[model samples]
Target: MHPQQQLALALLAYAAQRGLAVDRLARQSGLDTAALLSPTHGPLSAKQWHDLWLNAAQLARDPTFGLHFGEAATPAALGVVGQLVQSSRTVGEALTHGAALLPLLTDQVWLDLAHSPQSVWLRFRQLPTELAASATVVDHLVDFVLAFVLHELDGLLLERLQPRTVRFPPGARQLPEHLRVLRAATLAAGPPGEYSVELAGACWSMPLLTADYELQAALLQKITQWQAARPAVEPLRDKIAGYLLANAYLGIPSLEELAANFSTSARSLQRKLQAEGTNYQEVADAVRKSLALHYLKMGAYPIKEISYLMGYNELSAFSRAFKRWTGHSPAHYQPASASRSLPG
Candidate 1:
């Protein structure tokens, strides 16, 4: 999904504030600064967003850049969605409204609220098409989302609203100091691929200081009109791409498997994709290429591990594929300044 341009602009602003070169970052990420600042700019693709974060982290030389960026982010950075959430009557109502209107910001992930007798869990789950398969990209994205949510909650309550438990995805590399923003919450890695914060039930119904019934009603109407005009269905290629990214750990699905998921025969699926001027292999290759480039650009992972991540059983196979995608070998893409060793 294409994320609103405002998010990218906010990140650029944060980078500039930290003494990073925003022009170089924009150039590396294939973004035009003038176009981005223009009122008529369009949303960025999931790949572009991933590239921007990767570039930002590299320039800052900070693995926890996303966490810091989000810690400093304000609701105004989120554009319309922020305004609507701020005007909510209660914390629960704000969260509900935010989750419902999340697509206006980005459909890459959705916000979900789960309830138990004693606590409320706020979870952010990536949509199948969110192409952030690299560990680096996933780490930054998850950190930003979690920190941003906590920051917004604190703003609403006018106090440090500590979560009962803060969970990170397994294999996350955040240091304790980096997570100091989480306050005194119990920190533990949750499921293999999930991120969430558990809040006490008492905080759920707390009134938001910024609540304005009239403002919320007005914003909701405008958002509703905007949503009504959006296309109801995603393109076939995009759907297939999302499926691949979401289930990459299971290995790339076959044409038949993809067809079954969409409730169609393999032949029918092929014809539909062909009508869109591409085939299953083409779409699959594109997803693999995007994933490979993202990991390679980070310069953190070895080529072997990256190949495995791309679902290649043999290093040689992945090497050949990389060569075909780009004129040069993978080594040419890895930055010389990057450490060959992984971070602790």
Candidate 2:
């Protein structure tokens, strides 16, 4: 997929506000400032997007560049999905539309929604390993996404938009000023290995300031047509992972079955996964590891029960796999030690 030109313009605008010129940013990113500003430009590739972010962050000299840039974005800046979100009837509907269109944004991560008895959480799940290679970069990305959501929702429905809480991934270390600068009311870490934003259930049904049933219906039609016309560029790794999660209870499907589901041959599936720097077994193991950690931390399931749920015939097999994945026995991996509750 190509980089959305709207984003390039937004990046330029944000940098300009900070006294960084388009040419300088372009030079650092090896991007054509002219092309990025063109209305007809296609979406940027993953690497191109990464370079643009790094350059902007470096030039801004802000550890939270993504958050800052997100604050500057408007509804139209998000393109089609943004428009749909703007016309939605409620904040919850806008969130639904946002989650559905995430596959179009970046392959690096997809939205994962989790609901607790207290609140509903929207998390970015299954991030690309590369995104996690640097903790600082990941931190910026979390704030960046959350800031964008808040900025777009600003004064559109409520007098002020705020989440019940802002949650970072388990291992992330938040800066002391994160809450003050980000204006987060409640900030904490959760068990997910990636970032999440919590929405108060009470705010979910609030009517959108821009709601128009007739216009929104027409927009929905347009979204359907445009999405079908647009090519899907979601990463295979993510697709496979999603498929596994969807069908996990039935059993971890075989490579052949997965290939069949994707309408391809096993060999081709293997080749594609290989190109993405992963394999079927590796992906399966990763899914099991994530789910296992989730269950163990819940403290409601027995070790043997967790093993069976994860597709292991015996508890020993699951334990071995767990140790291999995290270098600790199931009991030794006190995931709950890090937090009061893990995002389910």
Candidate 3:
């Protein structure tokens, strides 16, 4: 459930431009400003993205905020996906590339392309998650995505797309005025919680104004090389260990909680772990050991405080584990220049 940080970064920039308190928004969303700015930082969890949109909605206090925010999105703000789309030869090709690369932006949502004899349909769907069930959040997100797509289409063609029909979630039927961006199209409510836009079948063949064959080839090559460098699917054991390590300071999650986070039942998760030659306890212990050793070597905090940070209920419990791991007391790892005081 980790989504690329680029979209979130763009949203933060938008919030700042709109005169909202970006710092406060980041804090409310449980996002660290430093991490958000760091190129090495991993993608944000789906919950953080949800919280960010929720907080933005609250702060803006404007029903049309998402629409405007999305309408203003620039290709520069969208990262590689934007650049690749811009370099595509035609409307259809650009959108196809966008759909294919959508996962690189956020795995939570996907863009689908369907065709009939007369029209091409672009569907936007969000995978169901506990955080994704928020109607307010979904409503705005749908608005943002729809507007952004339309904006991109119009930009690529150097002309207004004039979709034959635009469909929105049932909730938007009464707020047609808020969607003036799609005024040329016939507006209709789709399913209770679905969104899509219908464009002329011929629109797919429309040439993009900014198409560059050389640029597209180079971008595609770069993307292919990047994908080749990473595993298609991370091993479950490694995923669990990474999760435990990241959250060890906040207290480790129980097996049930971890299972829920990974969208699996406890039994299923156990089976998967067993198949990977590890179990929940083994992964947790490994993460704890790694963190414990790293913290001890850093000599930044006393052994007692380190125990608490590592989620140990008592210093004796931590000491025993440390002895088992290193065949020595935790104090032996401390450097002479290290401070004895706890971190504030």
Candidate 4:
């Protein structure tokens, strides 16, 4: 879930553009604004990135901040991935290349591109279900991508470009004026899984003004060299925790599925968890408890919705588990101090 520094700086810059209190937002997010202002910073975890998004929007009182931020993004603002995309031969090639390059940006999210008869659908979803708590961030993601694609191909078209349609999760807020500035874009709420942007076929195949193969080759080699030196293996417990957190919304994966995901067998996975001083159920419950406490403390959704989000069919079932996990039901867990923890 490590994201490049530019991702964080984008929000901060947006806040500054609107004249919000940068110091206060930094303090609220537990980020050091001074360090972040430097050109030399490292990657941020999924939670830290989310904190930046939430803090900026909250402090700015600008829910459509991401749209502006995305609209203003340049190759420099997005880092090497953006630069690589600009060097692609055509807008279609950029989309394909972007799908591959997205992993270089962040490992905690998924950027899936699906093609239809007359359009290309770009959908983004957070890998960790816990990260989906704030739907406002989804707005930023969709707006950002839409603006990004338009920027790359803006010269190919005679006029400004816009997505054919934009679909967001059930809970995200929309601002038509944001999209109206470039061109008309149909915006609507759909399912609660991913944020999507639908680009017409004509726009997809349009040529880019800045295509260059030699530069792209050099960047690709640099990226490949970096990947070649990654850690040979990751900790078994961390892998399990990440998997559990990501899938907890659908339902914790069965031990068999979990093992299969990691190319191991169920018994082997169980033994590994034991070697790490924990078991599968313990890991699953711990993840659920963590997400539950997060939502309860945020106090954004109702108890029933929180239960459904945590993968429970009945609120009573979630209440029972909360009682067992924290010696209190959802009602009493409102006090931030009432929330407890389990080893992650």
* Candidate with best TM-score: 1
Cα lDDT, all candidates: 0.71, 0.65, 0.69, 0.63
* Among all candidates shown, the one with the greatest lDDT: 1
Candidate 1 lDDT at 11 equals: 89
**Residues 1-344, model 4: lDDT tens digits:** 12368767766755654446778877777788778767666776567776777777667665665665555454555677776776777777888888887766655457887776688878887666545535666566556666656643553232356777777677666665455533546777867877777777676677765422332333334334434554545467655765455333234556765554444568998998899898888887887787677656654446775676566788888888988999877776565443342211
After superposing candidate 1 on the true structure, give the runs of residues whose Cα lies further than 4 Å from its correct spot: 1-3, 130-132, 211-344
TM-score of each: 0.58, 0.56, 0.58, 0.54
lDDT of 1 by residue, 1-344 (tens): 12368878988977865557899999999999998988778888777777898999888887777776666566656777777777788888888887787777655666789776699898766666637446687677767777777766764564567888877777777576344656636888888667788888887788976432332333334334434554546678876775565434334667875664444679999999999999999999997887677667766667876676576878888888989998778888888876762221
Estimate the lDDT of model 4.
0.63
Global local distance difference test of model 2: 0.65
Task: Report the candidate with higher lDDT, 1 versus 2.
Answer: 1
lDDT of 2 by residue, 181-235 (tens): 3566888887777677777776677788652233233333433443354334557
Better of 2 and 3 by lDDT: 3
Q: State the lDDT of candidate 3 residue by residue for 194-250, as single tens digits.
A: 678888899888887653233233333433443455454667887676555433333
The C-alpha RMSD of each candidate to the native structure, in angstroms, is 20.1, 21.2, 21.4, 20.7
